[model samples]
Target: MSELYKKSLKQIRDLLANREVSVTEVVRACIERINTTNKQLNSLVYVAAEQALEQAEKMDKEGPQPDRALWGVPIAVKDCICTKDLPTTCCSRMLADFVPFYDAYVVERLKVNGAIVIGKTNMDEFAMGSSTESSYFGITKNPWNTKLIPGGSSGGSAVSVAAAQCFGALGTDTGGSVRQPASMCGCVGVKPTYGRVSRFGAIGFASSLDQVGLFASTTEDSAILLEAIAGLDERDSTCSTRPIEAYSQGLTGDLKGVKIGLPKEFWQAGGIASEVLGEAEKAIDAARALGAEIVDVDMPHIPLSVAAYYIIAPAEASTNLSKFDGARYGFRAEGVETLDELYEQSRTQGFGDEVKRRIMLGTYVLSSGYYDAYYKKASQVRRLIQQDYLAALQKCDLLLAPISPVTAWEIGKHSGDPLKNYLMDIFTVSLNLAGLPGVAIPAGLGVESGMPVGVQLLGRAFDEHNLLKAAHRLEQAIPSIGSPKL
Candidate 1:
């Protein structure tokens, strides 16, 4: 085996660019790693080994293109992102056999940049649930400890990078899916500000909150991937027209004169494990030592983030998922009579429990007469949360916060307790509501469980340049969390 899978994205890119390794060698190493580790982790639902090798051989013959930033690199895409001629099941039975005719904007960008798509990773079905257990494809275990969860929705994408199955992977973040999983898997996760990356062909769980994100083992690798996929796309009306920055060029690894704020509410909020808090504190102290000023800021609406996010996210989910009723495409129920029966049976049989729970909750909130009391109120609270972020950013260049209240927990620890799982998202959901950019970096291991703990650095909307710079600097200062034993 080549062991090329162990290299970071940049190293792989360099080797290919220098003609030190053929693209086929790199792709094969990744496929071998996936074959070895994926059974236990369940990180990938579909491995495009033959397709990737064919692409790699062609790339080798054509030679590297200087203009393509990711030339010859092998990367994975989450199951929810559409890839032409490839299965994009979203880890849900509803779309189990669904394959789009056209690539998603991000996937198109990846192809244009000469990157090889290696596989489609597992995720929470329709990107619901805080843990990856909700996927119909079966749970994705944490590589650090097979008994623990790797975090929701984007868990497989995070695990793919953490376990060296691939150099990087694309994921979607709707209320902390990317960052939470990265935290648990001990990898770098970047959730750009909403609209910074197009959502054109990504299957939506919450239209308003969803944004495409990426996972890598290092901050530099994350910046490189983000730069490749981020830009204006006329196909997506919500995507910003602002010019994309050379995010990788901003990595000077210096944080002098930067101001980072700590929200008082986050620290005061109950139930944060001591080890998690300790790691966050150590990160803040390290920032101060790096010549960044640490200041206290207040966001009173922070406490309402979880409640408001659930109502708002679910409401949007209900509307977005209505198209999966078996009337047009996707999985249709057999032996169904009448239109209503087909719709009912298809949805009932296709969606997982978590997806159904959110759909019902969403439908209830958006139903006549109840919309104002539930959906409308939650929207109002969401705006207040956004205002809170806006106000806090005024006092500092960025905000430092915990990614999750605790390290990765044992599998089935919160089984049968969805509320406990929802609460696990308390530290992450607010960033989505605020539409801000955030990068989750490993803050070292938990003192008690010895699992990874992560801290996030949040920047104002569309300000990923500064956000990555600060995160890169801090990443250098913190001790490496070391790769998982897998």
Candidate 2:
């Protein structure tokens, strides 16, 4: 493996700018890394070696341009994110051969800024499961321990960065998919504020909750990628019109006068592991040592977050995914004599168990009679969750909490019981429910398994700037465990 594989996104950009390394070198190094490790980790669903190297060669001929923020950086995108020519299968048999015609908004931005898309990382089938095991392509093993599972649906994205296959990768967070996976893989993952980045070409998981997420080795990389992709998009109605922040630069790593909030409800919440909580407390102390005040706040409705998220997300997914009926595109079942049978046979054959389960749950909740009872009730609860976050954010600069209930679990530990896996997301789903920005930073190693433990800092809408700052400070105070040696 080349040393270039281990460089941070910022380092790669600087090297490219100074002509210390050619764009082809960086892209080839990453492709080589992916080729070397991807077999065991199953991180990448597709590797665009020829395309990436070709693009890098073109960039080398053109020379470096100071104006391009991510010029010549090699990055992998989650398979869920559309790449114009590459397959965007979402790791599902349903879209086994689905290659999109246009790039996702984030992908377009990366290309425009001269970032080479090395490949598409694996993900849960339609981004439904807590573990990447749900991916039709196969589970993505944790780089820290191949026996352990990488959290999903962005497990491959997290693993790609953690294993040094790429400087950074794009993931989507519907309910902690990005942050939780980053935490498990011991990398920096940021789920931007809901409208901070557009969702134009991302295959919808939960339309309202899904947001393009960033994964990198350092917080600065997260900030840089976020800046490169975030902004108003005429293509997406949900995208905000707010001006993008200069997130990569001007990061002081000082938290003086910053008020970090610890929600009482989070402390009292069920399922959070002791090590995870300890990590969050240590982060709090670290912030205090940096002159940031710690304040206790209440998010009374947080306990209902997971319940509400499942209902709302699945409901939206049921509706959003209805278009994949096998008639228009993607995998279509043969020998279907009628349209109804075709729809039934195609979906049954195309979708994995987890995807079917969610679709059924979603369809049931949205069904006429239950819509008023389940869907409406969940919507109201979702509002309360949002209000809880809004109220808590008013009391502090940002909210501090664990990214997941526990560290990465051994693969197949919860495979038999999907509900047990959902419980793993207790700490993460609430942020998505509230539509808030969150950055998960690796805090320490687990006592039992020596796996990575992460604590997240949640901020108000469009407050990624400060969230990254506080996270950087915590990162500095609490030493990282470093990358896994594959």
Output the number of the TM-score-best candidate. Answer: 1
lDDT of 1 by residue, 39-62 (tens): 999999999999999999999998
Query: Which lDDT values do the candidates have, in the order given?
Result: 0.92, 0.90
Off by over 4 Å in 1: none
- Per-model RMSD to reference: 0.9, 1.2
Highest-scoring model, lDDT: 1
Candidate 2: segments with Cα more than 4 A from true spot = none
Model 2: how far residue 25 lies from native, Å: 1.0
Cα lDDT for residue 381, candidate 2: 90
Q: Mind giving the per-residue lDDT tens digits that candidate 2 earns over 1-486?
A: 258987889989999999999999998888888889999999999999999889889989999998999999989999989999899999999998999999999999998888999889999899898789999898899999999889998999999999999999999999999999999999999999999999999999898899999999999899999999998899999999989989877776578888888898887777677777776677788888999988889888888887888889889999898998999997799998999999999999999999889999999999989998889999899899899899888888998888888888888899878778877778889888888999999988887778998888999999899889888877888877977988
